[model samples]
Target: MFEQALGIFLMLAILSVLIVVHECGHFLVARLFGFQTPVFGVGLPFGPYISLGRKWNTEFRIYAFLLGGFVAIPELGDETNASNSSEAFGVELNPFKKFPIWQRALVAVAGVTFNAIFAYFLMVVMFFSVGRQVEQTYVSALDPSNPIAKQAGVLAGDDIVALDKHPVTSTHEVIAYLGNRKSTPVTLSLIRDGKPLDLVMTTSPKGKVGMVLGQKPAQYIKIDAGPVETLGLAGSELVDRTRLMVVGLAEMVQALTPDFGPAQPGAPPKPGFKNLHGVLAVVKIGAGMVQIDWRSMFMFTIMISMDLAIINLLPWPALDGGHLAFMLVEAIRGKPIEERAHGEMVKWGFLSLIALMVLVMVNDVSALMNGELDIKPEMKEKLKGR
Candidate 1:
């Protein structure tokens, strides 16, 4: 029970920090543009609010429910509105609406931008401290019953150089390359005993080419990287991680279709509703990582930061991306959208967001009841060996 509580605490702490940083981006940028952002808060508004003092005319707040946060910038317009009048927060240099469209757009984008920047910084620190571990693209194991591997004539110890002409330096690269190609024949370039060979194999319906790549070393030899080198490496890693996440999301969407099939024997499970995790799962995973190592926990935090950035940038209503979309329309049309229309759209967007949260939570509970949260047998064995 204590372990569970610790995990929940850690998750909330990490999430609160991320939310605060995101809100701070909006608060600072809004203040810079002379817009009145009266409230900068951590946690959702549904919780009990505690004032955390004030700075720069902004009321900082901490809420009881520590899931997410917001920066409340009153609607920018003429001073006639009660909220904009002297009775409320004092009138600022300019109303939020009076600001140039470009400035407004920047304020909307600031939160996502800050999240991405934070993730990048975390990546740099991770690389510097733990050093990067580049896994070799060598076939380590193959299930004899895997028809695809047997037909492809792949052998243990064969070094995979490329897939369909795309150079692959690691097992993850190979998986990402093949995972996107369902029912497509792929050319695998391999080197075995100093002999180069080409083999062809079609992926299963589940998009898996039944084989496991060699595990990375238990201990990596850290290389000291200069500032320039570290930046380059971090940037490249960020791009790769972003690409993988996009692909994973796409796969999840595909899984929602009725035709989603089962995984092949000994193959990793296919993406499906079962893969949709919620806050509970996140807390559990975060706590588990904390117990394992600080490095792992830091890496998880970085991944969550990037995920937050991407999710906010998605062009959905009530999201930062949705606000940016409106700004884009306003820019092209040379006028702002009607206030009523904007408000209605945002209301629907909020409803949609809430619905999604409920759905994910339901899925999380179902998974827990079904005992599906445990690691797979194969993965468990691998972890034990490590």
Candidate 2:
């Protein structure tokens, strides 16, 4: 029990740091652009409670009741009182209100950008701390009954060059490209017998491109340059992995959309959507990762970071995307939305967000109790050995 509690606490701490860094991106950009951002918080609000006066003027005061480590930019474009008529009328620059629509939009997007950058940095650290591991390619032993390799006559040693014309340099890339493919035949370009060749490989209903490339451990240590080159390599690796994740997610979402051909009638029902997991889910996942191998832990961290970026960019209220949407509207209308209306929109957004969070929480709990969250026995044994 104590171990579980410690795991939960560790998870919360990691998540909190990630969230704070993301929000800080927004706060920093807002301040840089001359907006008066008064409060920076670390967690959801627990109501107006007196904060001990700290040396760094970290004393707490609550002006609004919604909890979440959030930043509050001063009300924009509201000058009802005579005392600040000039400021309201734009005689002086209203940092929040006076910015052009595009600038305001960037301030909102800064949070997601921060998440991406942080993920990249963390990825670099992981690479240096532990070198890359690649799985061996094994296409030779494919079942003769498999339609994909049979039609193409793809041999095991054929090095994959491209998938449907897209470059295939990495396993993650292979996963993303294959995820987008239908069961139909895909043209695979490969190098065989030291000659560039193309094959019309039919994919199986499972969507495999029908050829596997061999994998090996290829680690390069920059003993001379030490930290700098390692960091750069990690950054590049992060960008590569993040791109793959984003592409995979986009394909998944596309499949779920109603416009995508309805899942064949009577086909097994798709897994239910679990879109808005909140802090509790975050804690549980983090704890679970810590119990896994370093590779899994790092991969999960990157996945979570990507998830944060994608979700925050959706045009929903109380999200960066929401602010972006409003900024776009303001741009088109030639004026910012009324402060009251904006506030109401934010309130509604918060309510909807909370409702989604609750649903995800219930799903997480069910998934845990049902043993859905456990790693497979084989995988668990493998990781344990690692």
Candidate 3:
């Protein structure tokens, strides 16, 4: 019970920090533009609020609900009905519509920008402190009975220099190359006893290349990166991770669609919530990670930060991307959208977000009740084997 409580506390603390960083992006950018930001809050506004001091004339607040946060900029079409009395203290209170389109767009994008930046910062620290895990591409073992290895005449201790003429530096690259060329011929360049050789091998029916690529024993070697190199590494990692996340999200969306074909005679029935993960699933994952170690917890938090960055930038209503889209349209049209139309759009957008949240929560509950939420680690190991 104590462990469970500790997990919950850690999850909340990490989430709260991420939320504050995201909202601060908006708040700080808006303040820089001379906009009126009355409330900078952590967590959704509910119950009584406690004042956490003021910055730049903004009242920092801690609310009851801890799921997410907001930066209440009264001038930025805020629905909070906050008094404009503070407007008298500065330049005439200009509505968000009166601001330059670029400035408004910047405010809309600032939150996502900060999330990405935070993720990159976490990655840099991780690299400097714990280092990254990497694998070597040398062949350590070969199964003679495996068709691909036998046909290619590959021997143990050979380093995979290339696949299809592309340099292979890691076992991951070899697996990726073979996985994509299942049952197809692939060219493998090998270095054996310091002599280079080339061979063609066809993958087996199950996409196995029948080679066990070797890895140096795992060790944490901190990267000694200069300022410029650190920046370059951080930015590159952020971009690569974001791209991978997009592909993964697309796959998850595809998994949501039901496969209508009849099941094979002896095959097990398809699971209803195969790739869906919701709030409870995330919390459960957080709990497990915290129990393992701080490095694992930090790693998960960094990934979540990046995920939030990408998710908020998705071009859907009530999202940062959606707001930026409206700003872009205004820029192109030489005018802001009609207030009523904008309100209607926001209403629909909010409802859609709520609906999505509901669907995800329902899926999470279903997975929990049906014993599907606990298989993630096993599934991850299986994927790694592939």
Question: Measured by TM-score, how close is model 3 to the native structure?
Answer: 0.73
How do all models score by TM-score?
0.80, 0.73, 0.73
For candidate 1, lDDT tens digit of each residue in 226-301? 8898899888888887877887777677767765466557765556665678787777667755554445655678
Greater lDDT among 1 and 3 belongs to 1
Clashing residue pairs in candidate 1, if any? 76-96, 76-97
Q: Which parts of model 1 have CA positions greater than 4 angstroms off?
A: 1-7, 75-97, 134-153, 157-172, 179-221, 257-274, 375-386
Q: Which clashing pairs does model 2 show?
A: 44-68, 45-67, 45-68, 136-215, 137-213, 137-214, 137-215
Overall local distance difference test of candidate 2: 0.63
Relative to the true structure, candidate 2 has a C-alpha RMSD (angstroms) of 6.3
Comparing 1 with 2 on TM-score, the higher-scoring candidate is 1
